[model samples]
Target: MKRTIPPLLTAAALAAGCGTVSTSASSGGGEDAVTVESCGRDVTVDGVPERVVSMHPSLTELLVQLGVGDRVVAQAQDALGEPSPELAAEVDAITSISADVPPTREDLLAQSPDFVISGTEYEFSAEQGFAGYEDLEKAGAPAYVATAGCIDRRSEGAVADTFTDLENLGRIFGVEDRASELVTQAEQDLAEIEEIIGDDDPVRAVQVYVEGGKLYAIGGAVEIDVLRLGGGENLFAGDSRFDDFFAAEVNPEVVVDLQPDAFVFAVNDAAHEEQTRAYLEQTLADTPAVRNGLLVAVDNTYVQPGTLSAITGARIVAEALHG
Candidate 1:
């Protein structure tokens, strides 16, 4: 199915008045106003933000990967998934203001943060105690959403956008140098696989997520693009067989017919992972991917757009399909 750029980021452009960006202390500083347009709003970062609050896991994880998690004093506990051991320490120290819901306005105000980072637009609803970005600006705390995390829920989660978000954060925090280092490292990690798989024919595959006996395919461009970059061809990309790219339920018959060479399973926990494996093995036993033992299990974060997850996930897919 064809899709348009989300209205939030439709033809959005970045304008840094000074015409120069610094990787070191050259943040959105000086007399010139730093301009960034996100989800349909133009944001002028008047100054660097010190005290920051992250409202979702992806934002927190990004900060952690960028070496700035220590600065995020508070966040949504539920959104924060299992992290690396070192990040666990950092996450443990921060205040968990909400369990499964966005922190109320009072909760946000209590933090006294200088900047706010939200994962989804839904988090900014009045019900979540956020009157949205304008309210945050009025409260004197400017905020930003990860490029892929805008109002569009077409379910697009892209790693490239994660880098963009990181660059934006670095500009807002005077840490562009650190962001560059992380991006460079990610590029290097991904480059190794690209070199090895360049000659291999692309593998046809359909990645899916499993939850409570239900199967959902992964079709977001952010994720699909990575598959392409990793040297795998997404069978569902304009295959015309899929009626809805965002369909919540999967038809095993479709998988059996497509006969994808790989079955990429995105699971969050051991139980879900085991269930997905069993379902595929029992129902798709005769399928090419299953018969050939090409089932790949990856963390849900792998499809959720984080620096480490994206690089790691792509490498996993490449090794599974090409190696």
Candidate 2:
């Protein structure tokens, strides 16, 4: 499978970054101390985390790819989605929690997860349902949130961030080698995409989400950077044009005039796809995307960002635009 890690990044380099830093318990090939840094906080792992409760689907996919699917005692339901045949049984075996929200405090505590991985969008916020970092520690589990889900940060783009997550997970699960392999695959995938788009003028695209009968475009490039990196240009890069901050529901007529080459929609599920279909065939009837029929749906979970999702999402967007 094609992956998204940078080509020059060696396995030794990756393993070194995430491997146990201390040799106190290195009698064999064992890790003595492992730590993962997230949102500027360091989360230490004494040994491999056996009971990991993934609060998000992207994280669940990471576990499956890391070859530690059995370590996942339970995961946020639908986090893995309808698995792609190869992983059907593996995903089916794990218990599902809430699909759209954080599992309740009682529900989460019941699982007794040594590590809790959540998307920063909402689940990371304590008041939303699942407790905060402090709460996770109190419950005997270290809190880990995906950096991709973070707001207002560009220190790491999707590709780099995904690798970071994989490395961190590897550190915790003793799977640095597997993580490295995935990274190599990711690098090749990225190289292929870069070659496809190779110095060509970027294809202008307007990505939006349909909610409550309103059309809302993504405000930040953070989540959609993979698309941009894959050569899809954002029509809303400027603040004065689209106001990515407030993300005001723009008049569909406003978008029709942009005449984007492609229409990217946040179609997380079938319902979202159905919704965007209308936007394509009706609301933007006059645009190039509609006329050319260049409509694409991005899984919301995939948008959340992870090594696998980043690579897969990049490929999905690249195919839709230039396939």
Runs in model 2 lying further than 4 Å from the true structure:
1-31, 77-85, 152-157, 240-248
> Model 1 misses residue 266 by how many Å?
1.6
lDDT of 2 by residue, 245-286 (tens): 424467888888788888876554676588768857888889
Query: In order, what lDDT does every prediction score?
Result: 0.64, 0.65
Candidate 2, which ten residues in sequence have the lowest lDDT sum?
5-14
* lDDT score, candidate 1, position 34: 66
Worst 10 residues of 1 by lDDT: 15-24
| lDDT (Cα, tens digit) per residue for candidate 1, span 1-323 | 11121211211211112112111111243574565655555565667666788875546777887777778888863332344445667665777887545677788878887778875455555533454565677666666666765544324556677777778777777789999988888888878989868799999888776555556665654567567667788777765433333323567786788888888876545765788899999888878899898898765555553345666678878888887
